[model samples]
Target: MDGIIVVNKPKGMTSHDVVNVLRHKLKQKKIGHTGTLDPEASGVLLILAGKACKALQFLKDTDKTYQTSIEFGYITDSDDIFGNKIEVKEINYDFDFEKVLQSFIGPQKQKVPMASAKKINGKKLMEYQREGISNIDVYNEIEIYSISVLSKENYSFEVHCSSGTYIRSICRDFGYKTNNLCCMKELVRTKVGRFTLDMAQNLDEIEIDTVKLYPLSYLLDHIERIDYEPVLDIYNGKHVRIQTNANQVCIYDKEKPIAIYQRDHFDVFKSIRGLW
Candidate 1:
Protein backbone atom coordinates (compact mmCIF):
# COMPACT_ATOMS: atom_id res chain seq x y z
CA MET A 1 0.00 0.00 0.00
CA ASP A 2 3.10 2.24 0.05
CA GLY A 3 3.50 2.52 -3.74
CA ILE A 4 1.75 3.48 -6.95
CA ILE A 5 -1.48 2.12 -8.51
CA VAL A 6 -2.25 2.73 -12.13
CA VAL A 7 -5.98 3.07 -12.85
CA ASN A 8 -7.65 3.13 -16.22
CA LYS A 9 -10.15 5.84 -15.34
CA PRO A 10 -13.44 5.51 -17.15
CA LYS A 11 -15.27 8.43 -18.67
CA GLY A 12 -18.15 10.03 -16.67
CA MET A 13 -16.33 9.29 -13.38
CA THR A 14 -14.37 12.12 -11.81
CA SER A 15 -10.76 11.51 -10.79
CA HIS A 16 -11.73 11.74 -7.12
CA ASP A 17 -14.45 9.15 -7.71
CA VAL A 18 -11.81 6.63 -8.81
CA VAL A 19 -9.65 7.40 -5.75
CA ASN A 20 -12.67 6.95 -3.44
CA VAL A 21 -13.50 3.54 -4.94
CA LEU A 22 -9.92 2.30 -4.45
CA ARG A 23 -9.83 3.74 -0.93
CA HIS A 24 -12.82 1.60 0.01
CA LYS A 25 -11.50 -1.52 -1.73
CA LEU A 26 -8.03 -1.32 -0.25
CA LYS A 27 -9.10 0.18 3.07
CA GLN A 28 -6.24 2.63 2.82
CA LYS A 29 -6.85 6.24 3.87
CA LYS A 30 -3.70 7.92 2.53
CA ILE A 31 -4.38 7.33 -1.18
CA GLY A 32 -4.15 10.18 -3.70
CA HIS A 33 -3.64 10.71 -7.44
CA THR A 34 -0.69 12.12 -9.38
CA GLY A 35 -2.92 14.29 -11.55
CA THR A 36 -6.59 14.79 -12.32
CA LEU A 37 -8.28 13.80 -15.58
CA ASP A 38 -11.58 15.37 -16.52
CA PRO A 39 -14.58 13.11 -15.93
CA GLU A 40 -15.28 13.38 -19.68
CA ALA A 41 -11.77 12.04 -20.46
CA SER A 42 -10.35 8.62 -19.68
CA GLY A 43 -7.10 6.61 -19.48
CA VAL A 44 -3.96 6.32 -17.30
CA LEU A 45 -4.53 7.80 -13.80
CA LEU A 46 -1.69 7.19 -11.32
CA ILE A 47 -2.90 6.56 -7.77
CA LEU A 48 -0.39 7.15 -5.00
CA ALA A 49 -1.25 4.98 -2.02
CA GLY A 50 0.00 5.20 1.61
CA LYS A 51 3.51 6.67 1.79
CA ALA A 52 3.55 7.08 -1.96
CA CYS A 53 1.42 10.21 -1.56
CA LYS A 54 4.54 12.12 -0.49
CA ALA A 55 6.09 11.46 -3.92
CA LEU A 56 3.48 13.65 -5.62
CA GLN A 57 5.69 16.76 -5.90
CA PHE A 58 8.52 14.72 -7.45
CA LEU A 59 6.29 13.49 -10.29
CA LYS A 60 4.51 16.71 -11.15
CA ASP A 61 7.01 17.80 -13.82
CA THR A 62 6.84 14.54 -15.76
CA ASP A 63 5.60 14.77 -19.34
CA LYS A 64 2.34 13.21 -20.50
CA THR A 65 1.00 11.75 -23.74
CA TYR A 66 -2.58 11.68 -24.94
CA GLN A 67 -4.64 10.38 -27.83
CA THR A 68 -7.29 12.94 -28.65
CA SER A 69 -9.93 13.64 -31.27
CA ILE A 70 -10.65 17.16 -32.50
CA GLU A 71 -14.00 18.09 -33.98
CA PHE A 72 -14.10 20.97 -36.39
CA GLY A 73 -16.76 23.41 -37.63
CA TYR A 74 -18.12 24.17 -34.15
CA ILE A 75 -16.84 25.79 -30.96
CA THR A 76 -17.97 25.23 -27.38
CA ASP A 77 -17.93 27.30 -24.22
CA SER A 78 -15.59 24.85 -22.43
CA ASP A 79 -13.28 24.09 -25.40
CA ASP A 80 -14.70 20.58 -25.50
CA ILE A 81 -17.70 18.91 -27.10
CA PHE A 82 -19.49 18.54 -23.74
CA GLY A 83 -19.76 22.32 -23.41
CA ASN A 84 -22.57 24.45 -24.76
CA LYS A 85 -22.15 25.39 -28.41
CA ILE A 86 -21.07 28.97 -28.73
CA GLU A 87 -20.34 29.26 -32.46
CA VAL A 88 -20.54 27.26 -35.68
CA LYS A 89 -18.65 27.59 -38.93
CA GLU A 90 -18.13 25.70 -42.19
CA ILE A 91 -15.52 22.90 -42.05
CA ASN A 92 -12.30 23.36 -43.97
CA TYR A 93 -11.20 19.78 -44.38
CA ASP A 94 -9.03 20.78 -47.31
CA PHE A 95 -6.56 22.64 -45.12
CA ASP A 96 -2.95 21.41 -44.82
CA PHE A 97 -3.32 19.49 -41.55
CA GLU A 98 0.20 18.03 -41.30
CA LYS A 99 1.79 21.46 -41.63
CA VAL A 100 -0.39 22.82 -38.89
CA LEU A 101 0.42 19.95 -36.53
CA GLN A 102 4.15 20.46 -37.07
CA SER A 103 3.78 24.14 -36.28
CA PHE A 104 2.71 23.32 -32.72
CA ILE A 105 5.99 21.56 -31.99
CA GLY A 106 8.25 23.16 -29.29
CA PRO A 107 7.53 25.88 -26.73
CA GLN A 108 4.63 28.30 -26.75
CA LYS A 109 2.30 30.18 -24.42
CA GLN A 110 -1.11 28.55 -24.03
CA LYS A 111 -4.14 30.20 -22.48
CA VAL A 112 -5.73 28.12 -19.76
CA PRO A 113 -9.43 27.50 -20.40
CA MET A 114 -11.88 29.17 -18.05
CA ALA A 115 -13.79 25.90 -17.73
CA SER A 116 -10.70 24.21 -16.26
CA ALA A 117 -9.96 23.62 -12.56
CA LYS A 118 -6.98 26.01 -12.55
CA LYS A 119 -7.06 28.24 -9.48
CA ILE A 120 -6.85 32.02 -9.63
CA ASN A 121 -6.90 34.39 -6.62
CA GLY A 122 -7.46 31.32 -4.38
CA LYS A 123 -10.61 30.21 -6.25
CA LYS A 124 -10.92 27.55 -8.93
CA LEU A 125 -11.54 28.93 -12.41
CA MET A 126 -14.43 26.54 -13.06
CA GLU A 127 -16.14 27.79 -9.89
CA TYR A 128 -15.88 31.32 -11.22
CA GLN A 129 -17.32 30.25 -14.55
CA ARG A 130 -20.25 28.67 -12.70
CA GLU A 131 -21.01 32.02 -11.06
CA GLY A 132 -21.13 33.84 -14.46
CA ILE A 133 -17.69 35.42 -13.92
CA SER A 134 -15.67 34.32 -16.95
CA ASN A 135 -13.35 37.22 -17.69
CA ILE A 136 -10.18 35.63 -16.28
CA ASP A 137 -7.59 34.75 -18.92
CA VAL A 138 -4.48 32.98 -17.70
CA TYR A 139 -1.63 31.68 -19.82
CA ASN A 140 1.25 29.33 -19.10
CA GLU A 141 4.33 28.10 -20.92
CA ILE A 142 3.96 24.63 -22.42
CA GLU A 143 5.87 22.56 -24.92
CA ILE A 144 4.58 20.01 -27.41
CA TYR A 145 7.26 17.38 -27.83
CA SER A 146 5.55 15.71 -30.76
CA ILE A 147 2.21 15.16 -32.47
CA SER A 148 1.38 12.29 -34.78
CA VAL A 149 -1.76 11.86 -36.80
CA LEU A 150 -3.72 8.67 -36.15
CA SER A 151 -6.66 9.25 -38.46
CA LYS A 152 -7.37 12.37 -40.46
CA GLU A 153 -10.86 11.13 -41.24
CA ASN A 154 -11.68 11.00 -37.52
CA TYR A 155 -9.45 13.94 -36.63
CA SER A 156 -7.76 11.65 -34.11
CA PHE A 157 -4.13 12.26 -33.14
CA GLU A 158 -1.65 11.52 -30.39
CA VAL A 159 0.38 14.23 -28.68
CA HIS A 160 3.38 14.07 -26.34
CA CYS A 161 3.74 17.26 -24.34
CA SER A 162 5.13 18.86 -21.23
CA SER A 163 3.17 18.38 -18.04
CA GLY A 164 0.20 20.81 -17.65
CA THR A 165 -0.22 21.15 -21.41
CA TYR A 166 -3.95 21.18 -22.13
CA ILE A 167 -5.03 19.16 -25.17
CA ARG A 168 -8.36 21.00 -25.20
CA SER A 169 -6.56 24.28 -25.67
CA ILE A 170 -4.54 22.72 -28.47
CA CYS A 171 -7.73 21.65 -30.24
CA ARG A 172 -9.16 25.12 -29.88
CA ASP A 173 -6.00 26.64 -31.28
CA PHE A 174 -5.94 24.11 -34.10
CA GLY A 175 -9.35 25.31 -35.14
CA TYR A 176 -8.22 28.92 -35.04
CA LYS A 177 -5.18 28.14 -37.18
CA THR A 178 -7.27 26.19 -39.70
CA ASN A 179 -9.97 28.89 -39.95
CA ASN A 180 -12.67 26.54 -38.59
CA LEU A 181 -14.38 26.40 -35.22
CA CYS A 182 -13.22 23.40 -33.22
CA CYS A 183 -13.31 21.64 -29.86
CA MET A 184 -11.83 18.54 -28.24
CA LYS A 185 -14.25 15.75 -29.14
CA GLU A 186 -12.55 13.11 -27.00
CA LEU A 187 -9.39 12.55 -24.94
CA VAL A 188 -7.51 9.62 -23.42
CA ARG A 189 -4.28 10.01 -21.44
CA THR A 190 -2.01 7.28 -22.81
CA LYS A 191 1.08 7.96 -20.72
CA VAL A 192 2.42 9.87 -17.72
CA GLY A 193 6.17 9.95 -17.39
CA ARG A 194 7.27 6.28 -17.59
CA PHE A 195 3.79 4.91 -16.76
CA THR A 196 1.54 4.03 -19.70
CA LEU A 197 -1.92 2.73 -20.47
CA ASP A 198 -0.52 -0.78 -20.87
CA MET A 199 0.33 -0.78 -17.14
CA ALA A 200 -3.11 0.42 -16.00
CA GLN A 201 -6.13 -1.63 -14.94
CA ASN A 202 -9.84 -0.86 -14.95
CA LEU A 203 -11.12 0.20 -11.53
CA ASP A 204 -13.22 -2.98 -11.13
CA GLU A 205 -10.18 -5.18 -11.82
CA ILE A 206 -8.24 -3.78 -8.82
CA GLU A 207 -8.74 -6.37 -6.06
CA ILE A 208 -6.54 -6.07 -2.96
CA ASP A 209 -4.86 -9.46 -3.32
CA THR A 210 -4.26 -9.11 -7.06
CA VAL A 211 -3.58 -5.40 -7.37
CA LYS A 212 0.06 -4.43 -8.06
CA LEU A 213 1.81 -1.59 -6.29
CA TYR A 214 4.89 -0.43 -8.16
CA PRO A 215 7.88 0.32 -5.93
CA LEU A 216 8.69 3.93 -5.05
CA SER A 217 11.91 3.75 -7.10
CA TYR A 218 9.84 3.48 -10.28
CA LEU A 219 8.63 7.03 -9.65
CA LEU A 220 12.17 8.40 -9.82
CA ASP A 221 13.35 6.44 -12.87
CA HIS A 222 13.85 9.66 -14.78
CA ILE A 223 16.31 10.91 -12.17
CA GLU A 224 19.92 9.93 -11.94
CA ARG A 225 21.18 7.85 -8.99
CA ILE A 226 24.51 7.46 -7.25
CA ASP A 227 25.86 5.11 -4.62
CA TYR A 228 27.50 7.36 -2.07
CA GLU A 229 29.58 6.35 0.98
CA PRO A 230 27.74 8.27 3.74
CA VAL A 231 24.68 6.19 4.56
CA LEU A 232 23.85 7.80 7.93
CA ASP A 233 24.20 11.30 6.51
CA ILE A 234 21.66 10.51 3.81
CA TYR A 235 19.33 8.91 6.36
CA ASN A 236 19.65 11.92 8.65
CA GLY A 237 18.76 14.31 5.76
CA LYS A 238 22.18 15.96 6.05
CA HIS A 239 24.24 17.31 3.17
CA VAL A 240 26.54 14.63 1.87
CA ARG A 241 29.84 15.12 0.04
CA ILE A 242 29.73 13.79 -3.53
CA GLN A 243 31.41 14.42 -6.85
CA THR A 244 29.00 14.25 -9.76
CA ASN A 245 27.79 16.59 -12.46
CA ALA A 246 24.10 15.74 -12.08
CA ASN A 247 22.03 18.60 -10.69
CA GLN A 248 19.98 16.09 -8.70
CA VAL A 249 20.36 12.37 -8.04
CA CYS A 250 18.82 9.58 -6.02
CA ILE A 251 21.15 8.37 -3.27
CA TYR A 252 20.79 4.61 -3.30
CA ASP A 253 21.70 1.96 -0.75
CA LYS A 254 22.08 -1.29 -2.70
CA GLU A 255 18.72 -1.87 -4.49
CA LYS A 256 16.78 0.66 -2.41
CA PRO A 257 16.59 4.43 -2.78
CA ILE A 258 17.67 6.14 0.46
CA ALA A 259 16.77 9.65 -0.63
CA ILE A 260 16.86 12.13 -3.49
CA TYR A 261 19.60 14.76 -3.17
CA GLN A 262 20.02 18.03 -4.99
CA ARG A 263 23.46 19.54 -5.53
CA ASP A 264 23.93 22.18 -2.84
CA HIS A 265 27.17 23.86 -3.92
CA PHE A 266 30.41 22.63 -5.47
CA ASP A 267 30.42 18.86 -4.74
CA VAL A 268 27.98 18.82 -1.80
CA PHE A 269 24.49 17.24 -2.04
CA LYS A 270 21.52 17.96 0.21
CA SER A 271 18.44 15.83 0.76
CA ILE A 272 15.52 16.72 -1.51
CA ARG A 273 13.42 14.02 0.08
CA GLY A 274 14.15 10.78 1.92
CA LEU A 275 12.60 7.60 0.57
CA TRP A 276 12.23 6.15 4.05
Candidate 2:
Protein backbone atom coordinates (compact mmCIF):
# COMPACT_ATOMS: atom_id res chain seq x y z
CA MET A 1 0.00 0.00 0.00
CA ASP A 2 3.05 2.29 0.22
CA GLY A 3 3.52 2.72 -3.51
CA ILE A 4 1.98 4.06 -6.69
CA ILE A 5 -1.36 2.86 -8.14
CA VAL A 6 -2.05 3.74 -11.74
CA VAL A 7 -5.82 4.12 -11.88
CA ASN A 8 -7.72 4.58 -15.12
CA LYS A 9 -10.00 7.18 -13.66
CA PRO A 10 -13.50 7.28 -15.09
CA LYS A 11 -15.10 10.44 -16.37
CA GLY A 12 -17.51 12.36 -14.04
CA MET A 13 -15.38 11.78 -10.93
CA THR A 14 -13.01 14.44 -9.66
CA SER A 15 -9.50 13.30 -8.83
CA HIS A 16 -10.36 13.69 -5.14
CA ASP A 17 -13.34 11.37 -5.57
CA VAL A 18 -11.03 8.65 -6.86
CA VAL A 19 -8.76 9.09 -3.82
CA ASN A 20 -11.73 8.88 -1.48
CA VAL A 21 -13.04 5.71 -3.13
CA LEU A 22 -9.63 4.04 -3.03
CA ARG A 23 -9.11 5.12 0.58
CA HIS A 24 -12.35 3.37 1.55
CA LYS A 25 -11.60 0.25 -0.46
CA LEU A 26 -7.97 -0.03 0.58
CA LYS A 27 -8.56 1.24 4.13
CA GLN A 28 -5.51 3.51 3.81
CA LYS A 29 -5.79 6.91 5.47
CA LYS A 30 -2.91 8.65 3.65
CA ILE A 31 -3.53 8.71 -0.10
CA GLY A 32 -2.99 11.27 -2.83
CA HIS A 33 -2.87 11.74 -6.60
CA THR A 34 0.08 13.04 -8.60
CA GLY A 35 -2.04 15.36 -10.71
CA THR A 36 -5.62 16.55 -10.96
CA LEU A 37 -7.73 15.27 -13.83
CA ASP A 38 -10.83 17.24 -14.74
CA PRO A 39 -14.09 15.59 -13.71
CA GLU A 40 -15.19 15.52 -17.36
CA ALA A 41 -11.97 13.82 -18.47
CA SER A 42 -10.95 10.21 -18.06
CA GLY A 43 -7.76 8.07 -18.17
CA VAL A 44 -4.45 7.51 -16.41
CA LEU A 45 -4.38 8.96 -12.87
CA LEU A 46 -1.40 8.10 -10.65
CA ILE A 47 -2.60 7.44 -7.10
CA LEU A 48 -0.04 7.46 -4.32
CA ALA A 49 -1.00 5.69 -1.14
CA GLY A 50 0.99 5.62 2.14
CA LYS A 51 4.66 6.54 1.71
CA ALA A 52 4.22 7.17 -2.01
CA CYS A 53 2.52 10.47 -1.19
CA LYS A 54 5.94 11.94 -0.33
CA ALA A 55 6.85 11.77 -4.01
CA LEU A 56 4.01 14.09 -5.03
CA GLN A 57 6.01 17.35 -4.70
CA PHE A 58 8.85 16.00 -6.82
CA LEU A 59 6.57 14.60 -9.53
CA LYS A 60 4.69 17.79 -10.36
CA ASP A 61 7.15 18.90 -13.04
CA THR A 62 6.90 15.67 -15.03
CA ASP A 63 5.47 15.99 -18.54
CA LYS A 64 2.09 14.54 -19.48
CA THR A 65 0.47 13.33 -22.69
CA TYR A 66 -3.22 13.47 -23.51
CA GLN A 67 -5.51 12.33 -26.30
CA THR A 68 -8.27 14.84 -26.88
CA SER A 69 -10.91 15.67 -29.46
CA ILE A 70 -11.93 19.18 -30.50
CA GLU A 71 -15.25 20.32 -31.87
CA PHE A 72 -15.11 23.31 -34.16
CA GLY A 73 -18.08 25.59 -34.92
CA TYR A 74 -18.73 27.11 -31.50
CA ILE A 75 -17.15 27.65 -28.09
CA THR A 76 -18.67 27.77 -24.61
CA ASP A 77 -18.12 29.90 -21.52
CA SER A 78 -16.02 27.05 -20.26
CA ASP A 79 -13.28 25.91 -22.63
CA ASP A 80 -15.14 22.62 -22.98
CA ILE A 81 -18.65 21.71 -24.15
CA PHE A 82 -20.04 21.71 -20.57
CA GLY A 83 -20.50 25.48 -20.44
CA ASN A 84 -22.90 27.99 -22.00
CA LYS A 85 -22.33 28.87 -25.65
CA ILE A 86 -20.49 32.16 -25.88
CA GLU A 87 -19.54 32.29 -29.56
CA VAL A 88 -20.34 30.53 -32.81
CA LYS A 89 -18.66 30.44 -36.19
CA GLU A 90 -18.53 28.39 -39.38
CA ILE A 91 -15.93 25.61 -39.40
CA ASN A 92 -13.00 26.35 -41.67
CA TYR A 93 -12.43 22.88 -43.01
CA ASP A 94 -10.11 24.14 -45.73
CA PHE A 95 -7.56 25.53 -43.28
CA ASP A 96 -4.09 23.96 -43.06
CA PHE A 97 -4.61 21.96 -39.90
CA GLU A 98 -1.13 20.46 -39.81
CA LYS A 99 0.61 23.80 -40.03
CA VAL A 100 -1.63 25.31 -37.38
CA LEU A 101 -0.97 22.43 -34.99
CA GLN A 102 2.75 22.63 -35.60
CA SER A 103 2.70 26.32 -34.71
CA PHE A 104 1.74 25.41 -31.17
CA ILE A 105 4.70 23.06 -30.74
CA GLY A 106 6.82 25.42 -28.66
CA PRO A 107 6.64 27.52 -25.51
CA GLN A 108 3.84 30.03 -25.22
CA LYS A 109 1.52 31.67 -22.74
CA GLN A 110 -1.99 30.26 -22.42
CA LYS A 111 -5.04 32.02 -21.04
CA VAL A 112 -6.43 30.19 -18.00
CA PRO A 113 -10.13 29.51 -18.49
CA MET A 114 -12.68 30.78 -16.00
CA ALA A 115 -14.25 27.41 -15.28
CA SER A 116 -11.03 25.84 -14.09
CA ALA A 117 -9.54 24.80 -10.74
CA LYS A 118 -6.70 27.31 -11.13
CA LYS A 119 -6.82 29.78 -8.29
CA ILE A 120 -6.61 33.55 -8.48
CA ASN A 121 -6.07 35.48 -5.26
CA GLY A 122 -6.38 32.25 -3.27
CA LYS A 123 -9.78 31.46 -4.81
CA LYS A 124 -10.32 28.82 -7.46
CA LEU A 125 -11.53 30.14 -10.82
CA MET A 126 -14.43 27.72 -10.70
CA GLU A 127 -15.40 29.15 -7.30
CA TYR A 128 -15.37 32.62 -8.81
CA GLN A 129 -17.63 31.45 -11.64
CA ARG A 130 -20.24 30.16 -9.17
CA GLU A 131 -20.37 33.56 -7.49
CA GLY A 132 -21.06 35.46 -10.79
CA ILE A 133 -17.60 37.06 -10.92
CA SER A 134 -16.34 36.49 -14.45
CA ASN A 135 -13.91 39.31 -15.21
CA ILE A 136 -10.63 37.59 -14.42
CA ASP A 137 -7.67 37.20 -16.76
CA VAL A 138 -4.98 34.67 -15.91
CA TYR A 139 -2.18 33.32 -18.07
CA ASN A 140 0.58 30.80 -17.55
CA GLU A 141 3.60 29.55 -19.45
CA ILE A 142 3.16 26.23 -21.25
CA GLU A 143 4.93 24.22 -23.89
CA ILE A 144 3.59 21.66 -26.33
CA TYR A 145 6.30 19.07 -26.90
CA SER A 146 4.49 17.42 -29.80
CA ILE A 147 1.03 17.11 -31.33
CA SER A 148 0.00 14.15 -33.46
CA VAL A 149 -3.26 14.29 -35.31
CA LEU A 150 -5.23 11.10 -34.85
CA SER A 151 -7.93 12.06 -37.31
CA LYS A 152 -8.36 15.46 -38.87
CA GLU A 153 -11.82 14.41 -40.00
CA ASN A 154 -12.97 14.41 -36.39
CA TYR A 155 -10.43 16.97 -35.14
CA SER A 156 -8.90 14.44 -32.80
CA PHE A 157 -5.27 14.82 -31.80
CA GLU A 158 -2.78 13.64 -29.21
CA VAL A 159 -0.59 16.16 -27.41
CA HIS A 160 2.46 15.73 -25.23
CA CYS A 161 3.09 18.80 -23.14
CA SER A 162 4.49 20.30 -19.97
CA SER A 163 2.72 19.34 -16.75
CA GLY A 164 0.62 22.49 -16.32
CA THR A 165 -0.37 22.89 -19.97
CA TYR A 166 -4.13 22.85 -20.25
CA ILE A 167 -5.37 20.77 -23.21
CA ARG A 168 -8.68 22.64 -23.02
CA SER A 169 -6.87 25.91 -23.62
CA ILE A 170 -5.10 24.33 -26.56
CA CYS A 171 -8.45 23.42 -28.11
CA ARG A 172 -9.72 26.95 -27.62
CA ASP A 173 -6.55 28.43 -29.08
CA PHE A 174 -6.55 25.99 -31.99
CA GLY A 175 -10.03 27.12 -32.99
CA TYR A 176 -9.09 30.78 -32.77
CA LYS A 177 -5.97 30.17 -34.86
CA THR A 178 -8.06 28.46 -37.54
CA ASN A 179 -10.67 31.26 -37.59
CA ASN A 180 -13.37 29.08 -36.03
CA LEU A 181 -14.77 28.60 -32.55
CA CYS A 182 -13.88 25.33 -30.91
CA CYS A 183 -14.13 23.50 -27.57
CA MET A 184 -12.73 20.30 -26.13
CA LYS A 185 -15.22 17.51 -26.74
CA GLU A 186 -13.46 14.63 -25.07
CA LEU A 187 -10.17 14.11 -23.23
CA VAL A 188 -8.18 11.16 -21.93
CA ARG A 189 -4.81 11.51 -20.26
CA THR A 190 -2.76 8.77 -21.89
CA LYS A 191 0.52 9.36 -20.06
CA VAL A 192 2.11 11.09 -17.08
CA GLY A 193 5.88 10.96 -17.11
CA ARG A 194 6.64 7.22 -17.30
CA PHE A 195 3.15 6.04 -16.28
CA THR A 196 0.73 5.15 -19.09
CA LEU A 197 -2.88 4.11 -19.59
CA ASP A 198 -1.73 0.57 -20.32
CA MET A 199 -0.56 0.34 -16.71
CA ALA A 200 -3.77 1.74 -15.26
CA GLN A 201 -6.40 -0.33 -13.42
CA ASN A 202 -10.06 0.45 -13.90
CA LEU A 203 -11.33 2.05 -10.69
CA ASP A 204 -14.61 0.15 -10.71
CA GLU A 205 -12.93 -3.21 -11.33
CA ILE A 206 -9.88 -2.84 -9.09
CA GLU A 207 -9.78 -4.68 -5.75
CA ILE A 208 -7.48 -4.32 -2.75
CA ASP A 209 -5.78 -7.63 -3.35
CA THR A 210 -5.73 -7.13 -7.12
CA VAL A 211 -4.16 -3.67 -7.00
CA LYS A 212 -0.58 -3.36 -8.24
CA LEU A 213 1.57 -0.99 -6.26
CA TYR A 214 4.80 -0.01 -8.02
CA PRO A 215 7.99 0.28 -6.02
CA LEU A 216 9.63 3.67 -5.54
CA SER A 217 12.36 2.81 -8.04
CA TYR A 218 9.78 2.00 -10.72
CA LEU A 219 7.59 4.96 -9.83
CA LEU A 220 10.55 7.32 -10.13
CA ASP A 221 12.37 5.56 -12.93
CA HIS A 222 12.68 8.78 -14.85
CA ILE A 223 15.07 10.17 -12.26
CA GLU A 224 18.73 9.23 -12.46
CA ARG A 225 19.80 6.72 -9.83
CA ILE A 226 23.09 6.33 -8.03
CA ASP A 227 23.49 3.00 -6.29
CA TYR A 228 25.56 3.28 -3.13
CA GLU A 229 25.91 1.75 0.28
CA PRO A 230 23.34 2.83 2.87
CA VAL A 231 24.78 5.47 5.16
CA LEU A 232 23.64 7.69 8.04
CA ASP A 233 24.22 10.77 5.83
CA ILE A 234 21.35 9.80 3.49
CA TYR A 235 19.02 8.92 6.37
CA ASN A 236 19.79 12.12 8.26
CA GLY A 237 19.16 14.31 5.16
CA LYS A 238 22.83 15.20 4.84
CA HIS A 239 24.64 16.32 1.72
CA VAL A 240 26.93 13.86 -0.04
CA ARG A 241 29.36 14.35 -2.86
CA ILE A 242 28.35 12.46 -5.99
CA GLN A 243 29.26 13.04 -9.61
CA THR A 244 26.19 13.30 -11.85
CA ASN A 245 25.10 15.43 -14.78
CA ALA A 246 21.45 15.36 -13.69
CA ASN A 247 20.10 18.24 -11.60
CA GLN A 248 18.34 15.72 -9.35
CA VAL A 249 19.05 12.11 -8.54
CA CYS A 250 17.78 9.24 -6.41
CA ILE A 251 20.29 7.55 -4.14
CA TYR A 252 19.79 3.82 -4.15
CA ASP A 253 21.11 1.05 -1.96
CA LYS A 254 20.81 -2.55 -3.20
CA GLU A 255 18.46 -1.33 -5.96
CA LYS A 256 16.09 0.43 -3.56
CA PRO A 257 15.74 4.21 -3.45
CA ILE A 258 16.97 5.66 -0.14
CA ALA A 259 16.83 9.38 -0.76
CA ILE A 260 16.32 11.93 -3.49
CA TYR A 261 19.28 14.27 -3.86
CA GLN A 262 19.69 17.59 -5.61
CA ARG A 263 22.93 19.38 -6.41
CA ASP A 264 24.01 21.70 -3.66
CA HIS A 265 27.18 22.85 -5.34
CA PHE A 266 29.40 21.31 -8.03
CA ASP A 267 29.72 17.73 -6.79
CA VAL A 268 27.98 18.01 -3.44
CA PHE A 269 24.40 16.69 -3.42
CA LYS A 270 21.92 17.60 -0.70
CA SER A 271 19.13 15.31 0.34
CA ILE A 272 15.87 16.88 -0.86
CA ARG A 273 13.77 14.07 0.47
CA GLY A 274 14.47 10.62 1.83
CA LEU A 275 12.52 8.02 -0.08
CA TRP A 276 13.21 5.47 2.65
What tens-digit string does per-residue lDDT give for candidate 2 at 1-276?
788899999999999999999999999999988879999999999888887777777664379999999988899989899889988887788787778888899998889999988988899998998899888989989889999889878889999999779999999999888788999999999998888999999998878889999886666777998875547778888778887799899887777777889999999888888776
Clashing pairs in 1: none
Please write out the lDDT profile of model 1 over residues 1-276, one tens digit for every residue: 789998999999999999999999999999988889999999999999986777677774379999999988898889999999989999887687778888999999999998998999999889999999988989989999999999877988999999879999999999999888999999999998888999999999998998989988888777887887768877888888887888999888887776889988998888888777
Summed backbone clashes in each candidate are: 0, 0
Q: Which residues of candidate 2, in runs, are more than 4 Å off?
A: 222-224, 227-230, 237-249, 262-270
Model 1, 191: alpha-carbon shift in Å? 1.1
Q: Give the clashing residue pairs of candidate 2, or none.
A: none
Query: Model 1, stretches more than 4 Å misplaced?
Result: 228-230, 265-268
TM-score of each: 0.91, 0.89
